[model samples]
Target: MTEERPVRWLDEAEMAAWRSYVVATLRLRQRLHRELTDRHDVSLTDYEVLVCLEMQDAYRMRMSELAVLMGSTKSRLSHQVGRLEGAGLVRRGRDPEDKRGVITELTDEGLALLATAAPTHVEGVREHLIDLLSPQEQATIAAAFERVLEHLSEAES
Candidate 1:
Protein backbone atom coordinates (compact mmCIF):
# COMPACT_ATOMS: atom_id res chain seq x y z
CA MET A 1 0.00 0.00 0.00
CA THR A 2 1.17 3.53 -0.73
CA GLU A 3 1.98 5.69 2.26
CA GLU A 4 -0.36 8.66 2.71
CA ARG A 5 1.23 12.07 2.78
CA PRO A 6 0.48 14.38 5.68
CA VAL A 7 -1.71 17.26 4.58
CA ARG A 8 -0.70 20.81 5.30
CA TRP A 9 -3.41 22.56 7.23
CA LEU A 10 -4.28 26.21 7.55
CA ASP A 11 -3.08 27.90 10.74
CA GLU A 12 -5.25 30.34 12.69
CA ALA A 13 -4.37 33.42 10.68
CA GLU A 14 -5.03 31.71 7.37
CA MET A 15 -8.28 30.20 8.65
CA ALA A 16 -9.53 33.59 9.79
CA ALA A 17 -8.75 35.15 6.43
CA TRP A 18 -10.38 32.32 4.51
CA ARG A 19 -13.49 32.19 6.65
CA SER A 20 -14.01 35.95 6.51
CA TYR A 21 -13.65 35.97 2.76
CA VAL A 22 -16.19 33.16 2.34
CA VAL A 23 -18.81 34.65 4.62
CA ALA A 24 -18.42 38.19 3.32
CA THR A 25 -18.65 37.12 -0.29
CA LEU A 26 -21.82 35.10 0.39
CA ARG A 27 -23.58 37.77 2.44
CA LEU A 28 -22.59 40.51 0.04
CA ARG A 29 -24.14 38.63 -2.84
CA GLN A 30 -27.27 37.94 -0.81
CA ARG A 31 -27.65 41.58 0.19
CA LEU A 32 -27.19 42.73 -3.40
CA HIS A 33 -29.67 40.12 -4.61
CA ARG A 34 -32.22 41.18 -2.05
CA GLU A 35 -31.96 44.84 -3.00
CA LEU A 36 -32.35 44.08 -6.69
CA THR A 37 -35.24 41.70 -6.23
CA ASP A 38 -37.09 43.98 -3.88
CA ARG A 39 -36.74 47.18 -5.91
CA HIS A 40 -36.42 45.93 -9.46
CA ASP A 41 -37.84 42.41 -9.45
CA VAL A 42 -34.54 41.09 -10.82
CA SER A 43 -32.13 38.61 -9.30
CA LEU A 44 -28.42 39.24 -8.95
CA THR A 45 -27.60 36.70 -11.65
CA ASP A 46 -30.05 38.34 -14.04
CA TYR A 47 -28.53 41.74 -13.37
CA GLU A 48 -25.09 40.30 -14.04
CA VAL A 49 -26.26 38.75 -17.31
CA LEU A 50 -27.72 42.05 -18.44
CA VAL A 51 -24.59 43.90 -17.44
CA CYS A 52 -22.51 41.45 -19.47
CA LEU A 53 -24.60 42.01 -22.57
CA GLU A 54 -24.47 45.77 -22.06
CA MET A 55 -20.68 45.62 -22.09
CA GLN A 56 -20.68 43.98 -25.51
CA ASP A 57 -20.93 45.91 -28.74
CA ALA A 58 -24.52 46.67 -29.68
CA TYR A 59 -25.48 44.93 -26.46
CA ARG A 60 -25.19 41.55 -28.06
CA MET A 61 -22.97 38.51 -27.48
CA ARG A 62 -22.66 34.92 -28.58
CA MET A 63 -24.40 32.48 -26.27
CA SER A 64 -21.27 30.35 -25.88
CA GLU A 65 -19.11 33.36 -25.08
CA LEU A 66 -21.67 34.64 -22.58
CA ALA A 67 -21.83 31.25 -20.89
CA VAL A 68 -18.07 31.25 -20.46
CA LEU A 69 -17.99 34.84 -19.23
CA MET A 70 -20.64 34.09 -16.63
CA GLY A 71 -18.90 30.85 -15.57
CA SER A 72 -22.10 28.97 -16.31
CA THR A 73 -22.90 25.90 -18.39
CA LYS A 74 -24.71 26.47 -21.67
CA SER A 75 -27.81 24.63 -20.46
CA ARG A 76 -28.13 26.75 -17.33
CA LEU A 77 -27.53 29.93 -19.27
CA SER A 78 -30.19 28.84 -21.73
CA HIS A 79 -32.77 28.57 -18.98
CA GLN A 80 -31.81 31.94 -17.57
CA VAL A 81 -31.98 33.52 -21.01
CA GLY A 82 -35.37 31.93 -21.58
CA ARG A 83 -36.69 33.59 -18.43
CA LEU A 84 -35.26 36.94 -19.47
CA GLU A 85 -36.78 36.56 -22.91
CA GLY A 86 -40.17 35.90 -21.36
CA ALA A 87 -39.79 39.12 -19.42
CA GLY A 88 -39.07 41.01 -22.69
CA LEU A 89 -35.60 41.86 -21.51
CA VAL A 90 -33.59 39.89 -24.06
CA ARG A 91 -33.96 37.91 -27.26
CA ARG A 92 -31.96 35.23 -29.05
CA GLY A 93 -31.16 34.87 -32.69
CA ARG A 94 -28.76 33.09 -35.06
CA ASP A 95 -25.46 34.79 -35.72
CA PRO A 96 -25.45 36.00 -39.31
CA GLU A 97 -21.79 35.17 -39.91
CA ASP A 98 -22.14 31.75 -38.28
CA LYS A 99 -25.57 30.23 -38.68
CA ARG A 100 -24.77 27.51 -36.17
CA GLY A 101 -24.04 29.99 -33.41
CA VAL A 102 -26.72 31.64 -31.29
CA ILE A 103 -26.53 35.29 -30.26
CA THR A 104 -28.21 37.02 -27.33
CA GLU A 105 -29.20 40.65 -27.59
CA LEU A 106 -30.58 42.97 -24.95
CA THR A 107 -33.85 44.59 -25.96
CA ASP A 108 -34.74 48.25 -25.56
CA GLU A 109 -36.91 47.30 -22.63
CA GLY A 110 -33.94 45.55 -21.08
CA LEU A 111 -31.76 48.62 -21.47
CA ALA A 112 -34.39 50.78 -19.83
CA LEU A 113 -34.74 48.38 -16.94
CA LEU A 114 -31.00 48.23 -16.50
CA ALA A 115 -30.84 52.03 -16.52
CA THR A 116 -33.47 52.18 -13.81
CA ALA A 117 -31.76 49.57 -11.68
CA ALA A 118 -28.20 50.82 -12.10
CA PRO A 119 -28.30 53.41 -9.31
CA THR A 120 -29.76 51.01 -6.76
CA HIS A 121 -27.12 48.43 -7.62
CA VAL A 122 -24.32 50.98 -7.54
CA GLU A 123 -25.41 52.41 -4.22
CA GLY A 124 -25.73 48.96 -2.74
CA VAL A 125 -22.21 48.10 -3.90
CA ARG A 126 -20.77 51.31 -2.54
CA GLU A 127 -22.56 50.96 0.77
CA HIS A 128 -21.94 47.28 1.25
CA LEU A 129 -18.37 46.87 -0.08
CA ILE A 130 -16.52 49.90 -1.38
CA ASP A 131 -17.29 52.26 1.48
CA LEU A 132 -16.06 49.64 3.93
CA LEU A 133 -12.58 49.69 2.42
CA SER A 134 -9.99 52.43 2.45
CA PRO A 135 -8.47 53.29 -0.95
CA GLN A 136 -5.32 51.31 -0.18
CA GLU A 137 -7.28 48.32 0.98
CA GLN A 138 -9.42 48.46 -2.17
CA ALA A 139 -6.30 48.52 -4.32
CA THR A 140 -4.80 45.61 -2.44
CA ILE A 141 -7.97 43.58 -2.77
CA ALA A 142 -8.15 44.30 -6.48
CA ALA A 143 -4.53 43.33 -7.05
CA ALA A 144 -4.84 40.15 -5.01
CA PHE A 145 -7.97 39.05 -6.84
CA GLU A 146 -6.45 39.91 -10.17
CA ARG A 147 -3.61 37.56 -9.42
CA VAL A 148 -6.04 34.87 -8.32
CA LEU A 149 -8.08 35.27 -11.48
CA GLU A 150 -5.01 35.16 -13.71
CA HIS A 151 -3.73 31.98 -12.06
CA LEU A 152 -7.12 30.26 -12.27
CA SER A 153 -7.56 31.33 -15.91
CA GLU A 154 -4.20 29.83 -16.78
CA ALA A 155 -5.27 26.54 -15.23
CA GLU A 156 -8.42 26.49 -17.38
CA SER A 157 -6.49 26.42 -20.63
Candidate 2:
Protein backbone atom coordinates (compact mmCIF):
# COMPACT_ATOMS: atom_id res chain seq x y z
CA MET A 1 0.00 0.00 0.00
CA THR A 2 1.13 3.55 -0.72
CA GLU A 3 1.90 5.85 2.18
CA GLU A 4 -0.95 8.15 3.19
CA ARG A 5 -0.47 11.83 2.51
CA PRO A 6 -1.07 14.43 5.20
CA VAL A 7 -4.05 16.73 4.74
CA ARG A 8 -3.26 20.35 4.04
CA TRP A 9 -4.52 23.00 6.42
CA LEU A 10 -6.24 26.22 5.48
CA ASP A 11 -3.97 29.25 5.11
CA GLU A 12 -4.48 32.13 7.53
CA ALA A 13 -6.41 34.20 5.01
CA GLU A 14 -8.59 31.25 4.02
CA MET A 15 -9.26 30.40 7.68
CA ALA A 16 -10.24 33.98 8.44
CA ALA A 17 -12.52 34.14 5.39
CA TRP A 18 -14.20 30.86 6.32
CA ARG A 19 -14.85 31.99 9.89
CA SER A 20 -16.15 35.34 8.73
CA TYR A 21 -18.48 33.67 6.27
CA VAL A 22 -19.84 31.36 8.96
CA VAL A 23 -20.36 34.21 11.43
CA ALA A 24 -22.01 36.47 8.89
CA THR A 25 -24.36 33.76 7.64
CA LEU A 26 -25.40 32.79 11.15
CA ARG A 27 -25.99 36.40 12.15
CA LEU A 28 -27.98 37.14 9.04
CA ARG A 29 -30.22 34.14 9.55
CA GLN A 30 -30.75 35.01 13.19
CA ARG A 31 -31.71 38.56 12.36
CA LEU A 32 -34.09 37.45 9.66
CA HIS A 33 -35.70 34.90 11.91
CA ARG A 34 -36.16 37.42 14.68
CA GLU A 35 -37.65 39.97 12.36
CA LEU A 36 -40.12 37.48 10.94
CA THR A 37 -41.07 36.03 14.29
CA ASP A 38 -41.53 39.36 15.98
CA ARG A 39 -43.55 40.92 13.20
CA HIS A 40 -45.55 37.94 11.96
CA ASP A 41 -45.41 35.45 14.81
CA VAL A 42 -44.12 32.84 12.39
CA SER A 43 -40.95 30.86 12.72
CA LEU A 44 -38.40 30.92 9.91
CA THR A 45 -39.03 27.25 9.27
CA ASP A 46 -42.76 27.87 8.94
CA TYR A 47 -42.17 30.72 6.56
CA GLU A 48 -39.90 28.53 4.43
CA VAL A 49 -42.50 25.77 4.29
CA LEU A 50 -45.22 28.20 3.37
CA VAL A 51 -43.10 29.66 0.61
CA CYS A 52 -42.33 26.21 -0.73
CA LEU A 53 -45.97 25.18 -0.81
CA GLU A 54 -47.07 28.47 -2.34
CA MET A 55 -44.57 28.01 -5.16
CA GLN A 56 -45.69 24.48 -5.93
CA ASP A 57 -48.07 23.89 -8.82
CA ALA A 58 -51.02 23.11 -6.57
CA TYR A 59 -49.88 24.75 -3.38
CA ARG A 60 -49.21 21.28 -2.08
CA MET A 61 -46.44 18.69 -1.97
CA ARG A 62 -45.91 15.17 -0.76
CA MET A 63 -44.71 14.94 2.84
CA SER A 64 -41.53 13.15 1.87
CA GLU A 65 -40.78 15.62 -0.89
CA LEU A 66 -41.36 18.53 1.48
CA ALA A 67 -39.06 16.97 4.03
CA VAL A 68 -36.32 16.74 1.43
CA LEU A 69 -36.92 20.28 0.19
CA MET A 70 -36.85 21.68 3.70
CA GLY A 71 -33.70 19.75 4.61
CA SER A 72 -35.54 18.21 7.50
CA THR A 73 -36.13 14.63 8.56
CA LYS A 74 -39.53 13.08 7.94
CA SER A 75 -40.29 12.90 11.66
CA ARG A 76 -39.42 16.55 12.20
CA LEU A 77 -41.49 17.54 9.20
CA SER A 78 -44.44 15.57 10.48
CA HIS A 79 -44.21 17.35 13.80
CA GLN A 80 -44.05 20.77 12.17
CA VAL A 81 -46.92 19.93 9.88
CA GLY A 82 -48.95 18.82 12.86
CA ARG A 83 -48.27 22.13 14.57
CA LEU A 84 -49.32 24.06 11.47
CA GLU A 85 -52.40 21.93 11.19
CA GLY A 86 -53.28 22.67 14.80
CA ALA A 87 -52.91 26.36 14.03
CA GLY A 88 -55.27 25.83 11.04
CA LEU A 89 -52.56 27.07 8.72
CA VAL A 90 -52.07 23.82 6.82
CA ARG A 91 -53.82 20.55 6.11
CA ARG A 92 -52.75 17.00 5.39
CA GLY A 93 -54.46 14.63 2.99
CA ARG A 94 -53.84 11.23 1.53
CA ASP A 95 -51.97 11.36 -1.75
CA PRO A 96 -54.25 10.53 -4.68
CA GLU A 97 -51.75 8.38 -6.55
CA ASP A 98 -50.14 6.71 -3.54
CA LYS A 99 -52.54 5.45 -0.90
CA ARG A 100 -49.76 5.10 1.64
CA GLY A 101 -48.34 8.58 1.11
CA VAL A 102 -49.37 11.87 2.74
CA ILE A 103 -49.57 15.26 1.12
CA THR A 104 -49.30 18.63 2.84
CA GLU A 105 -51.42 21.45 1.52
CA LEU A 106 -51.43 25.08 2.50
CA THR A 107 -54.69 26.46 3.84
CA ASP A 108 -56.30 29.72 2.77
CA GLU A 109 -55.36 31.13 6.13
CA GLY A 110 -51.76 30.18 5.46
CA LEU A 111 -51.83 31.88 2.11
CA ALA A 112 -53.28 35.02 3.65
CA LEU A 113 -50.65 35.02 6.36
CA LEU A 114 -47.91 34.55 3.78
CA ALA A 115 -49.28 37.36 1.67
CA THR A 116 -49.22 39.70 4.64
CA ALA A 117 -45.76 38.67 5.75
CA ALA A 118 -44.03 38.39 2.41
CA PRO A 119 -43.77 42.12 1.74
CA THR A 120 -42.17 42.72 5.11
CA HIS A 121 -39.79 39.82 4.60
CA VAL A 122 -38.84 41.15 1.18
CA GLU A 123 -38.25 44.56 2.65
CA GLY A 124 -36.02 43.12 5.35
CA VAL A 125 -34.05 41.20 2.74
CA ARG A 126 -33.67 44.34 0.65
CA GLU A 127 -32.57 46.44 3.61
CA HIS A 128 -30.18 43.88 5.06
CA LEU A 129 -28.78 42.33 1.88
CA ILE A 130 -29.91 43.17 -1.63
CA ASP A 131 -29.70 46.92 -1.21
CA LEU A 132 -26.22 46.68 0.26
CA LEU A 133 -24.80 44.93 -2.80
CA SER A 134 -24.31 46.47 -6.21
CA PRO A 135 -26.03 44.67 -9.08
CA GLN A 136 -22.74 43.20 -10.25
CA GLU A 137 -21.89 42.13 -6.71
CA GLN A 138 -25.30 40.47 -6.41
CA ALA A 139 -24.68 38.53 -9.59
CA THR A 140 -21.24 37.49 -8.42
CA ILE A 141 -22.60 36.42 -5.05
CA ALA A 142 -25.33 34.34 -6.70
CA ALA A 143 -22.83 32.70 -9.04
CA ALA A 144 -20.52 31.88 -6.13
CA PHE A 145 -23.39 30.34 -4.15
CA GLU A 146 -24.48 28.32 -7.19
CA ARG A 147 -20.98 26.92 -7.49
CA VAL A 148 -20.94 26.05 -3.81
CA LEU A 149 -24.33 24.33 -4.11
CA GLU A 150 -23.17 22.36 -7.14
CA HIS A 151 -20.00 21.30 -5.34
CA LEU A 152 -21.98 20.19 -2.29
CA SER A 153 -24.48 18.19 -4.39
CA GLU A 154 -21.61 16.51 -6.23
CA ALA A 155 -19.97 15.67 -2.92
CA GLU A 156 -23.20 14.13 -1.65
CA SER A 157 -23.64 12.08 -4.79
Candidate 3:
Protein backbone atom coordinates (compact mmCIF):
# COMPACT_ATOMS: atom_id res chain seq x y z
CA MET A 1 0.00 0.00 0.00
CA THR A 2 1.17 3.52 -0.72
CA GLU A 3 1.87 5.75 2.26
CA GLU A 4 -0.46 8.73 2.73
CA ARG A 5 1.30 12.02 2.22
CA PRO A 6 0.58 15.06 4.32
CA VAL A 7 -1.71 17.58 2.74
CA ARG A 8 -0.22 20.87 1.58
CA TRP A 9 -2.96 23.23 2.61
CA LEU A 10 -3.12 26.75 1.25
CA ASP A 11 -1.72 29.51 3.45
CA GLU A 12 -3.67 32.69 4.14
CA ALA A 13 -2.06 34.66 1.33
CA GLU A 14 -2.52 31.90 -1.20
CA MET A 15 -6.14 31.42 -0.12
CA ALA A 16 -6.82 35.11 -0.61
CA ALA A 17 -5.34 35.11 -4.09
CA TRP A 18 -7.20 31.96 -5.10
CA ARG A 19 -10.50 33.26 -3.75
CA SER A 20 -10.09 36.55 -5.58
CA TYR A 21 -9.47 34.79 -8.87
CA VAL A 22 -12.46 32.52 -8.33
CA VAL A 23 -14.83 35.35 -7.47
CA ALA A 24 -13.64 37.55 -10.29
CA THR A 25 -13.95 34.80 -12.88
CA LEU A 26 -17.44 33.76 -11.80
CA ARG A 27 -18.69 37.32 -11.52
CA LEU A 28 -17.28 38.23 -14.90
CA ARG A 29 -19.02 35.34 -16.65
CA GLN A 30 -22.28 35.80 -14.72
CA ARG A 31 -22.51 39.49 -15.55
CA LEU A 32 -21.78 38.89 -19.22
CA HIS A 33 -24.32 36.06 -19.45
CA ARG A 34 -27.00 38.14 -17.77
CA GLU A 35 -26.40 41.16 -19.98
CA LEU A 36 -26.43 39.08 -23.13
CA THR A 37 -29.67 37.41 -22.13
CA ASP A 38 -31.40 40.64 -21.16
CA ARG A 39 -30.32 42.72 -24.14
CA HIS A 40 -30.20 40.18 -26.95
CA ASP A 41 -32.32 37.21 -25.85
CA VAL A 42 -29.18 35.18 -26.36
CA SER A 43 -27.30 33.16 -23.78
CA LEU A 44 -23.54 33.34 -23.42
CA THR A 45 -23.28 29.78 -24.70
CA ASP A 46 -25.06 30.66 -27.94
CA TYR A 47 -22.97 33.77 -28.38
CA GLU A 48 -19.82 31.71 -27.95
CA VAL A 49 -20.90 29.25 -30.62
CA LEU A 50 -21.62 32.12 -32.98
CA VAL A 51 -18.30 33.74 -32.24
CA CYS A 52 -16.47 30.46 -32.82
CA LEU A 53 -18.15 29.99 -36.17
CA GLU A 54 -17.52 33.60 -37.07
CA MET A 55 -13.83 33.15 -36.46
CA GLN A 56 -13.56 30.19 -38.79
CA ASP A 57 -12.95 30.29 -42.52
CA ALA A 58 -16.18 30.89 -44.45
CA TYR A 59 -17.78 31.33 -41.03
CA ARG A 60 -18.20 27.57 -41.08
CA MET A 61 -16.72 24.66 -39.19
CA ARG A 62 -17.20 20.96 -38.80
CA MET A 63 -19.56 20.18 -35.93
CA SER A 64 -16.87 18.33 -34.02
CA GLU A 65 -14.40 21.15 -34.49
CA LEU A 66 -16.98 23.70 -33.47
CA ALA A 67 -17.78 21.72 -30.34
CA VAL A 68 -14.11 21.67 -29.35
CA LEU A 69 -13.71 25.39 -30.03
CA MET A 70 -16.81 26.21 -27.99
CA GLY A 71 -15.71 23.83 -25.22
CA SER A 72 -19.13 22.22 -25.32
CA THR A 73 -20.30 18.65 -25.36
CA LYS A 74 -21.38 17.35 -28.73
CA SER A 75 -25.00 16.87 -27.63
CA ARG A 76 -25.22 20.27 -26.00
CA LEU A 77 -23.61 22.02 -28.94
CA SER A 78 -25.92 20.15 -31.31
CA HIS A 79 -28.94 21.42 -29.39
CA GLN A 80 -27.57 24.94 -29.30
CA VAL A 81 -26.91 24.80 -33.04
CA GLY A 82 -30.45 23.57 -33.54
CA ARG A 83 -31.82 26.65 -31.79
CA LEU A 84 -29.62 28.94 -33.85
CA GLU A 85 -30.66 27.11 -37.00
CA GLY A 86 -34.29 27.54 -36.08
CA ALA A 87 -33.76 31.27 -35.63
CA GLY A 88 -32.30 31.44 -39.13
CA LEU A 89 -28.98 32.53 -37.69
CA VAL A 90 -27.17 29.34 -38.68
CA ARG A 91 -27.46 26.34 -40.91
CA ARG A 92 -26.17 22.77 -40.84
CA GLY A 93 -25.05 20.96 -43.93
CA ARG A 94 -23.21 17.86 -45.04
CA ASP A 95 -19.43 18.02 -44.91
CA PRO A 96 -18.27 17.52 -48.48
CA GLU A 97 -15.18 15.52 -47.70
CA ASP A 98 -16.88 13.32 -45.16
CA LYS A 99 -20.43 12.32 -45.90
CA ARG A 100 -21.13 11.28 -42.31
CA GLY A 101 -19.77 14.49 -40.84
CA VAL A 102 -21.78 17.70 -40.29
CA ILE A 103 -20.86 21.31 -40.91
CA THR A 104 -22.15 24.45 -39.23
CA GLU A 105 -22.15 27.87 -40.87
CA LEU A 106 -23.28 31.29 -39.76
CA THR A 107 -26.07 32.68 -41.89
CA ASP A 108 -26.47 36.32 -42.89
CA GLU A 109 -28.99 36.60 -40.09
CA GLY A 110 -26.42 35.30 -37.63
CA LEU A 111 -23.82 37.82 -38.78
CA ALA A 112 -26.35 40.63 -38.48
CA LEU A 113 -27.37 39.50 -35.01
CA LEU A 114 -23.73 39.28 -33.98
CA ALA A 115 -23.18 42.81 -35.27
CA THR A 116 -25.92 44.09 -32.98
CA ALA A 117 -24.91 41.99 -30.01
CA ALA A 118 -21.15 42.57 -30.24
CA PRO A 119 -21.38 46.15 -29.02
CA THR A 120 -23.43 45.25 -25.98
CA HIS A 121 -21.10 42.35 -25.18
CA VAL A 122 -18.02 44.51 -25.56
CA GLU A 123 -19.51 47.17 -23.34
CA GLY A 124 -20.30 44.59 -20.70
CA VAL A 125 -16.75 43.25 -20.91
CA ARG A 126 -15.32 46.75 -20.60
CA GLU A 127 -17.58 47.73 -17.74
CA HIS A 128 -16.77 44.62 -15.80
CA LEU A 129 -13.20 43.99 -16.86
CA ILE A 130 -11.04 46.08 -19.20
CA ASP A 131 -11.99 49.45 -17.76
CA LEU A 132 -11.00 48.31 -14.29
CA LEU A 133 -7.41 47.41 -15.27
CA SER A 134 -4.39 49.45 -16.31
CA PRO A 135 -2.47 48.41 -19.39
CA GLN A 136 0.15 46.54 -17.39
CA GLU A 137 -2.45 44.84 -15.26
CA GLN A 138 -4.32 43.76 -18.37
CA ALA A 139 -1.18 42.38 -19.92
CA THR A 140 -0.27 40.53 -16.76
CA ILE A 141 -3.72 39.04 -16.50
CA ALA A 142 -3.56 37.94 -20.14
CA ALA A 143 -0.15 36.38 -19.71
CA ALA A 144 -1.27 34.55 -16.59
CA PHE A 145 -4.27 33.11 -18.38
CA GLU A 146 -2.11 32.14 -21.31
CA ARG A 147 0.02 30.10 -18.96
CA VAL A 148 -3.07 28.44 -17.57
CA LEU A 149 -4.29 27.68 -21.08
CA GLU A 150 -0.95 26.22 -22.05
CA HIS A 151 -1.02 23.95 -19.03
CA LEU A 152 -4.52 22.80 -19.89
CA SER A 153 -3.57 22.13 -23.50
CA GLU A 154 -0.63 20.10 -22.33
CA ALA A 155 -2.92 18.03 -20.12
CA GLU A 156 -5.25 17.42 -23.05
CA SER A 157 -2.44 16.00 -25.12
Q: Best-fitting candidate, measured by TM-score?
A: 1
Name the runs in model 2 displaced over 4 angstroms.
1-5
Residues 28-104, candidate 1, lDDT per residue (tens digit)? 99999999999999999999999999999999999999999999999999999999999999999999999999999
Per-residue error for 14 in candidate 3, Å, reads 1.8
- Total backbone collisions for each predicted model: 0, 0, 0
Which residue pairs show collisions in model 3?
none
lDDT of 2: 0.92
Per-model TM-score versus the true fold: 0.96, 0.92, 0.92
Shift of residue 128 alpha carbon in model 1, Å: 0.5
TM-score of candidate 3 on Cα atoms, chains taken together? 0.92
Predicted candidate 2 versus true structure: per-residue lDDT over 1-157, tens digit per residue: 9999998999999999899889988888888889899999998889999999999988999999999889899999999999999999999999999989999999999999999989888888898889999999999999999999889878868
Compute the lDDT for candidate 1.
0.98
Ranking by lDDT: 1, 3, 2
Q: Rate the local accuracy (lDDT) of all candidates.
A: 0.98, 0.92, 0.93
Best by lDDT: 1
